[model samples]
Target: MKSRYILAALLATATVMPVASFAQQSAPAPAAANPASQIPAADKQAIQNFNLTDDVFNRIVKVSQEAKAQGIKPKDAKTDFSKIHSLDDLAKQVTDSDPRIAPLIKKYGFTPREFLLANLAVTNAAIASEAKGNPRMAAYVDQSKVNQKNVAFYEAHKGQINALMNEEPDPAAK
Candidate 1:
């Protein structure tokens, strides 16, 4: 009984003193030579497969929203968002005639819409930097069919793919 009491006291003291958490600091890291800043191979490919019609942009936006709801930590979601300037930029990019991305997507069997949704999840993290009236955000004129496709992709892949970039297990807790 005496040992139990001492153990409890020690545990209480440790809890009260606190310990450093592994959580990353809220501040953005300093700009430096880092690969995370560069768009990954997948992102670049999705850009070439993109068809920048309004429909596609709308779809990508919906995918981004769905990604957020699915516990996707934007900062860590897939590739970094800083690589994209705006929805238009992204749509145009995915639709670009990049020789690299188009062939890769063909090999992977990813539909253009699927590629676009993935692009949104990856890039939405960059919004913090672009939201300050970045001309890249663009004005919303209307929604389109591709928008619906994006939302659907988000619904289907939100857990599987969108979750990839955001999930970080609590190893210490284990």
Candidate 2:
């Protein structure tokens, strides 16, 4: 029962964290009227390389939308995602604490860390590109630098991360 609460809280945190961070920064410009053209080529390639399938990415967007509708806030205002060194840190903490999370993440073909890292990379790239024309969005450009570093870290350790995820018992095996 306690674990369920923890999982809920973590999921909630995951949903709201980015929104809260963006809120602290300036409001983003309206997205390009054409959605398909919005993602830059480099960002698209990064998403593909990370294997963040449409289903996985859509689910993440859905969670963010829900969080916004509910006006959720971060559990801790001081939590700075820029400081996260690697996806491994996120994956281990979440999966180790709640076995249930591992399977859900696996369903999306991601470790928890991979999911977060990929999403952050894609999001930051889009925001940074948009910020390029707007002086007010300078902070997003800085945030994007942090995200790019983390994504590079993930790419460097991709094989090891996949091996670690594979070591976990498949949910179906149970």
Candidate 3:
């Protein structure tokens, strides 16, 4: 999978872990039974306007890893894996579902909303940096508005982030 898709999948799995597990333990259901919620206007703006701060970026990364370590698994066969429009959808679902994952986000000092925004911002910046000279990918994500500092941070931390992404999902998450 592309790195972008991998990152997105990782985030989605983390957010859906608790809910998916519950749904599985309860009864069998259609995969797409749970539809994605509409993202509020305020959240849409927050996601668009967000510029990643180093602290927020660090917290997001740390909280993601901690969540996995604490047994929050990625998408399993039981997961709906429904298509979501943006990080806003993931954030709303995670926060609204009252999942255990929400507390981990808060433990790192980010509301689910804030963490999603930072996630999008940092992901965008990283994608933009990689797309700088590549025409096809560049056309997909706007490279101009990405924060330079965020891009620089992504460049500096690229190895660490890649390593994390490539790590096997913690079995305890099951």
Winning model by lDDT: 3
> Higher TM-score: candidate 1 or 3?
3
Deviation (Å) of 99 in candidate 3: 1.7
Off by over 4 Å in 2: 1-56, 59-85, 129-133, 139-174
The deviation in Å at residue 58 for candidate 2 is 3.4
**lDDT for every model?**
0.33, 0.43, 0.56
Question: What range of 10 consecutive residues in model 2 has the weakest lDDT sum?
Answer: 1-10
- Residue 7 lDDT in model 2? 23
Write down the TM-score of every candidate: 0.23, 0.36, 0.63
Instruction: Kindly list the per-residue Cα lDDT of model 2 for residues 24-86, writing each as its tens digit.
Output: 444554434222233344443443345434465555544433333333323432333443333
lDDT of 3 by residue, 88-118 (tens): 5566655554376677778889776677667
Q: List the residue pairs that clash in candidate 3.
A: none
lDDT of 1 at 65: 37
Deviation of model 1 at 122, angstroms:
7.8
lDDT of 1 at 20: 9
Q: List the residue pairs that clash in candidate 2.
A: none
For candidate 1, give the lDDT of residue 21: 12
